[model samples]
Target chain A: MNLVDKQLVKNKMGMRLIRNKLIKQLFLMATLFAIIILGTLLYRIFTQGIGYLDWEFFLSFASRFPEEAGIKAAIIGSLWLMAITAPISLILGVGTAIFLEEYASKNKWTRFIQMNISNLAGVPSIVFGLLGLTVFVRLLEMGRSIIAGGLTMSLLILPIIVVASQEAIRSVPNDQYEASFAMGATKWQTIRRVVLPAAIPGILTGGILALSRAIGETAPLLMIGALTFIAYLPENIWSGFTVMPIQIFNWTSRPQEEFHYVAAAGIIVLLVMLLIMNSIAVFIRNKFSKRY
Target chain B: MLTVERNRPMASSISPIKDNSIYTVRNFNLWYGADHALNDICMDIPTNKVTAIIGPSGCGKSTYIKALNRMVELVPSVKMTGSIDYNGQNIFNPKFKVEELRTSVGMVFQKPNPFPKSIYENVVYGPKIHGIKKKQILDEVVEKSLKGAALWDEVKDRLHENAFGLSGGQQQRLCIARCLAIEPDVILMDEPTSALDPISTLKVEELVQSLKKEYSIVIVTHNMQQAARISDNTAFFLNGEVIEYNKTDQIFSNPTDKRTEDYITGRFG
Candidate 1:
């Protein structure tokens, strides 16, 4: 038979073929859209911000105006924030996740709490700002203080931290629990020694992702009353504080073009910090997943 | 063709473990959600004997064994109306803690589920939970249980290694050692070697035969040959009912129930 004449060709659409084409087209579209958006963002950031970087930018402290400024106070503010937010959020978020996963019996109340958490995750960051302002700042009367800002940020992202932590803890296989029980270990012992170690990497990844989000948040801080400009370093919880985002906002809002360049410098520093946080999260995830 | 194979004490004319003594079950019924899982199970387990429950799939043999220590309570939808007597007391009594009861009657699953921990930690995990914090005592218990399971020599050199690193046979032996360390009254095994190769199956079978010297054992297995080889007493369950109970030799050679004989001879499942 000849190659062209002896073969059959399909002219009708099969359901499977239509579905396959849809899936392939969808995947290609998503990938291309993601790459394009990411490229644009990186290009805009690097072009405006890259040339503004210098040795003095890293060394000198912030000024009331961008005419005499660096990110020293802002960087220190971020470092201090990490010191407070990381441990406090970790304890509360991981504890709540474990409680929901392990000890909460099947009931409507537990379901209600779970629904509230997911809804809180969906709630806008600025809404949390209003919440923190009303509850933590004005209601508590801890006004314009660094601790108030940090604690307010903690409240803002607490749902994300808890939700991600719950997912991490739940990913552990049920066999591990059964194995520990069969070996006559108590419930607390099993959780403390076996389940926690197995879930550590996942928990750390969730935590770092959440903390990165907290680092980028300025709307909540603004609502909770953060000082945009500060000359002196904060030594106590009640001292006035200014973070990198507030510093960037202060510089960018000025009438001078030089101030616009300084805002670019602050954005660059923030990008590098967020990058390091993401890298640490990926590293921890890989390390523990291998052991498990 | 069957020979009586039981350890008889010379001074005792009757087996004290029998004659309405030891763990007694009376008119037990269990349900999983709306499905009746076990029905009307009436039997007594001896103090120091291996009781093998053999049956087809969905026959409630596994359900009956879990009823011994109320391990069935863990399943959220499980409900039971039965009195399981352990040492002349109803195991379902209000004061009995489920944790304590489970500790006293340890269980091994069908698959070898070793902890993601060192071999030494797997053995010592039990004692540590029971408030035995003295390092010296925990050391003794780990060594003794590992030696009893016949795994000490092979795993002794690398006691600190993760248990998942071991072979399947070694891991199953490690699980048995884990159960043995708590000093339980009865050890319940649910198809302990169903997930292993023939070699690991044989090793676990041999270990079960020797284990009866210290602990009462109840095993649920689908393999007829394994029941014939390792158990002292045999039970046959079919469709959530006890079809027959007899000595092991009688079960393999001459079962009273036609269903049991048919199952043993491989005529039908």
Candidate 2:
């Protein structure tokens, strides 16, 4: 109502607008900082590695010389490791999730178990490697084999998958469960027919992310004593193996400048593999979401 | 003796329920944790007839019906005492399996809940789980059940289409057809038409009338007129107690209890 008060209100409004713009700029800068760093890293990798990524680069085996070195053995070994890791972790993880979600009552013991599982996911991966060394390699006599590495990787990612699966199962509408139960469906029948189908898209997304993490993991494999210079592909679950990360790690640490370029090429292959896996998961999730 | 009288409350009589009764509930009480959801419920649900339960919200009508098939046990903290006999066998007996009780008593909800599957698959799901796997038998069951629910003509050509593709009323009918596919003796509908349009409600009321000729139906409805229109017997529940159980005409026209009269006349819920 007064001239002085009106001017004060106008000044306050201007200051508030200035503050809002400043915060918006700050957030924009924060976002762009991450994007720019990632973009620069990608550009560097592509430029450093593109010359080495030829047909022969995928077909030949790792050699003493960088010019002749390839990731064929490492690629095959990683595939073999994943072939062992994916099923074991997924089945066990999903099974545990269903039991906890559908069957268990809400009690202190189950809550404790749930809390510990979440904590287990945050534990350092090297601890799992030590466990694998003591249990799988040394105690169980599985000694530096693909199965040892696969089992270690599985333990590392099992918590992530279980948590993801529990969320998926929980997200299914209560009405769906009630409908199935009213039809005289036993618990198992209802789960098999209704719950699993509805939750598959979410479960697949989690499992793929876990698997991609398993693929890129180097510390656990190194701790389990995976060979860093394997020139031959693994023949079976029991055979000694070296994955792409181990090969890349070895190349990056070598004295030769050419080996660092080779390491970049190996990183590109790993990224592509992760991209392919993630794309398949996204495709399946979209198809299921649309259908349902 | 000129007309069948389902008028008397079961507590006032010493005689056993008639042999034609599909369910005999005696002094049944249910608690959700510490909340008394259903208190001292006593009634007889007649076979091959429509029984409508009319009540205000939280009056235990849905709880009582769900207890008939022991579906109330799905809630973790539910506690119950007293007996509900389905076809002369106590459903709560340890020897009595829940699966068998549910096989005979299927429920439809207030909301249309169709499985996200093909219409044919949805119909066949109950029978398929019950071990009727032959294609010929499943096909016949689908056809008969869909026709029984009066949903065949609209969905017959699109049996393979997902059940979610249908409208709400069609989906409700599909759920009914799915229930019928199991060939259950009783169908428990919990306010099935509360979510429907007037035309759809009329269609479902007609279906319920026709359905009772083959299967016993117990429907809970908030709409007083709908209960009077579709039900042969009506029970008026208030505050988790059945205030009156009688023929539908008498309940609407001459409710013996003042509470039932107050509820039906819309003075207060």
Candidate 3:
């Protein structure tokens, strides 16, 4: 090879190797950055919260003193809220999904509705709180009760559940529907027996995700005036309630160092609850997937 | 068993009732939106016989068979004219319920699509929907239908297992068994063996032949040899029209139409 050609080849090889190394290192650094930040946060939370995460922390009611405070009332309130939110959101969300996916005609109106739902999912959760404040709290006279808070949370997560459910329902194979129809099944019969069963795993997955969001949501519930200092469990749907995230938010806002530890402890509890819900969702999905 | 006799004269001259014609289609035409899918066609499908519709891809054979059971209407903007008479009743008539008509005219698709359910549930799905609730009756129906599809011996022990556990051929046979559970008067097969291996295709072809003894079967197949092997009568469709339809022997051996001859000889699609 000529001297110029040899030098040119050398330069090309060197550049290629250097570029590859640079790109790989850049990606690795990006991933490590995320892991380091997350690791630090987790380490801090565990260290600060471990001492406060005992049975007393769970059994005692919320109090002015950080050492005496517990999440007993908040835990019950969160459970009550979920008991209302889960069924309402699941039924309404799945119903909307079925109507849109199976019944609604694919036309301008459906596209318009679909576009609006996607947009609703992106809108700030606090906006839903305002809407719920007006509709449920003032107009409906629900008045900051657990029912009002649950309804607000449902509205907040409704779009996510609907979109998730629609995706799930749409993923069911067209062949299954055709097979069911070929067997003398009506539209309703096919949907009930084949389409819904096949889509249930996806629906449950979406529902669990939405419920997790509902559990962690404090802004909407706070906007709806859920009390942060309730000492007793809710007596009925009409009774006011406070959830874990709100209680933690209340603790972290206090002008005391010890309350921050209590906040970290409350965060750990919320995380565990979310983990349990997610595990149930995964179990259900796997069981149903194996069946088909 | 029906004899596989070749060179038998066409039964066109006999009255449909005497000849046991289960379906008498006349001047049937179909359009999906502006595109014509099936042209004006007239044919007679005899009861207790296998009639195969042979065509290349998109030649409208599947559309014609779907029209027989009123399934063609499921597509959006589908328009049909003329009549398909099933047992002397026009299936498209306003008084005829599509669901009731479908109950007597079961269909199997190109893909073996068993519901994501247990084998027992898949088989008993049809009868159960029509209100056969007793477990004893459902068990009997499941066994008889599986036997009818030649799948009972293989699947009897695993009836409660998920239907997806079966192999491709077994799944197809399971679908056939599911169809049989309803005890329909006719079974429509839409290229039912196209998705299977050679051995599985042979198994399905044999099952189709055996099923003809009990139910009138209308099959659409791209495989010409499959049509010849399983059908008593064959219809050659090209470009949304039936060029010639006759006894299977004549259609394959001495097709009157030049187009049918060219197609059968594989000169062109």
Candidate 4:
């Protein structure tokens, strides 16, 4: 090649390398932007709330005085909410997933149902609150009870669980199904014995993540009329409840600056609960993934 | 039984005929949606012998074996027309239960697919599904089935270990043991040793030879020498049709059809 042509190629190659580096730096910045925001939020919450995370802060109930406010009632209320939401969502969700994957024929009608389910997962959480208000609260006359709020939360997470469970069930290898069926196992027997066990770890991971979302949800419970000032634990499914998010939301709205710190403390508690639930999910997935 | 004796006929014939036939497939044609996967096929699989189906890829050898136990029906779009009579009962007869048919006809796949459970549990899966609840009975079944598959000694001490822990060859044998636990009369193997090492392949071939003493065995293989080595009868398939069927020695030594001779000679697949 001539010297001029060689020089031109070198210039082009240098430009291309610079362009690649520029795009890589741009993507790196985009990722770091999200991490920076999350880091700042975590830093702010931990610093502002660490002082308020004493035993006394956990023992007392919501008070007009931020110094006396606590999350005892909210903690119990969130637990109660999960007690109802987890089983209802899991049973209904996994059942629906199994039916859609295993039993339902791949026809126009099933496709229609499948499309609607995917659409439901994207529907806003507040819209589900409105749904719960209509169906569980006013229509059922359950009155601001834990069951009413829990059922609403279940409805909110049902689509998420169902979609995740469907993916899990679908991921089971066809060989497993064939082997089970070739052994004279009936459809139900194959599903119950082989499919369900193989799909459980996935189902549990998804179901737990969905349940954690329900625990952190505020707008739905608020719309369902969960009290912001409950001082005692819910006595039954019919009893009034106040979850951590609603309590934290209430404190954030207060005029006193001290209340903001209390809200940060509530956020810390909620984050810890979510972390523990997620850890359990990871544990179950790792344990079962190794087996199969 | 609803006998449809007027089904269209196919051309291939089995020679050196035996009196006791486990499966008599007559004009069996299968279609996956609009695509005809298996054309009219006819063969009499002799009882108490290893019958091998040899074919190139996508020639419907695997499909033919799957059809014996009605496992092909699992595919949503599959449609079949014709009859496969098993022990004098038409398998496709509406009155004949598929579960009962499967309980009598077991299958081992090309890949070793033991369940992600204990070795003992894998062998007992079929029996448990068949409603054998007693632990003592299950223990005996596990031992007998493993022994029958020639896997008893290798896995005896580690019966409680996960089946996945076994070697690939052992896993395949465990699957055979699992099938034997159901005590099926006929065992269908779809390229059972195709995924194994040469040593493992020879072991499985020997197992098949031993297994045929009691259970009727029908195997599909891509390896021509393996067919000659282990099978009593061999059927050559091409383009979804059975080109020739005869005694293994006759087919290998003196193929009747020109195409069969070419396939056997490795001139063309």
Q: Write the per-residue lDDT of candidate 4 for residues A104-143, one digit (tens) a residue.
A: 9999999999999999988988999998999999999998
**DockQ winner between candidates 3 and 4:** 4
In candidate 1 the C-alpha lDDT for residue A67 amounts to 49
TM-score of each: 0.90, 0.95, 0.94, 0.95
Error of 4 at A266 (Å): 1.0
Tell me each candidate's i-RMS in Å: 2.1, 1.6, 1.6, 1.2
Q: Please, what are the lDDT tens digits per residue for candidate 4 over residues B39-95? A: 988888999989999988999999889999999998889999988999989999999
Tens digits of per-residue lDDT, candidate 2, B56-171, equal 99999999999998988999999999889998999999999999989989999989988899999999999988889899999999999999999999999999998989988999
For candidate 1, write residues B191-233 as lDDT tens digits. 9989899998998899998998888899999998899999988
Candidate 2 CA-lDDT value:
0.91
lDDT at position A37, candidate 3: 100
Q: After superposition, how far is residue B224 of candidate 3 from its true place, in Å?
A: 1.4
Summed over model 4, clashes come to 0
Off by over 4 Å in 1: A1-33, A64-67, A290-292, B1-22
Better of 1 and 2 by DockQ: 2
Clash pairs for candidate 2 = none
Cα distance off (Å), candidate 2, residue B149: 1.1
Q: Write the per-residue lDDT of candidate 3 for residues A1-292, one digit (tens) a residue.
A: 4557877787799899999999999999999999999999989998998899999999999999989999999999999999999999999999999999999998999999999999999999888889989999999999989999999988889999999999999899888888888889999999898888889899999899889989999888888899999788899999988999999999999999999999999999998899999998889888775343
